[model samples]
Target: MKKLLISLTAAGILAGCSASDSGNGQEGPPETEVKTEEDPVTTDYLQERFYEGMDYDAYAVEIQTWVDKGQASISDTVKIEGQEDVSADIIQVADGFLAVANDSKEITFIKPFASPEDAKEYLKKNL
Candidate 1:
């Protein structure tokens, strides 16, 4: 009975130690990999097409804010409260304004510029 008890106690201790051991052979909490806001994972898709070094998220947020306020609208022609008339329905992209219209049954990719002003100017002059 004494030998059986000793064996059981030894097994329990070993099991407990292994359960708490960090895979590095050290006993304690496992190491965790931490990331910061500047990390690529944190930025996600915003990494592409930055404006004045700002991420796409910030730019998109600004545009969406305007849209929510009824300051911006996208349709056959984009109408911004304070900006000039846009030639076609404009979708804000990381790079610039993209003309979008549902009338055409074809897919089209408008070349994006680097600034919102450029998009507005393009619309004013071209469309």
Candidate 2:
């Protein structure tokens, strides 16, 4: 019984000595942390490059639109050449006779000049 009591006391002392007491130290509430701002990504981002590139016919139409809004001096016809003859809708003031179609999908907007004279051009241009 005496050995058992001494053994228990020694074990308790050993356990107490092994346990750390620093967790209760006076460490004035955790320091107020200031979160740093995250920097923006430099790459790996898709963008509107095609939209940024204003095609010539699109530009002409935009100019005509601006002209039509207030002034009538701009003589740009804003013609749009599509797969079918949609002159009425395309040549008018609103859609600038413009549209995003399957042809633009296969090729960029610079496939060919939007001019009806594309067939008669002297530079061997494709109609």
**What's model 2's lDDT at 106?**
29
Show model 2 residue runs off by greater than 4 Å. Answer: 1-64, 69-82, 85-108, 111-124
- Model 2 accuracy (lDDT, Cα): 0.31
Top lDDT hit: 1
Candidate 1 CA-lDDT value = 0.43
| Tens-place lDDT digits, model 1, residues 1-127 | 9999999999999988877774456332222223233542111222232223233334445445545644433423445443342223455433235543221232222435455566667655653
TM-scores for every predicted model: 0.26, 0.17
Q: What is the C-alpha lDDT of each candidate?
A: 0.43, 0.31
Name the regions of candidate 1 deviating beyond 4 angstroms: 1-87, 94-97, 101-109
Give the range of the ten consecutive residues with the poorest summed lDDT in model 2.
Answer: 41-50
Model 1, residue 45: distance off in Å is 11
lDDT of 2 by residue, 37-60 (tens): 242211111112123333435434
| Candidate 1 least-lDDT 10 residues | 40-49
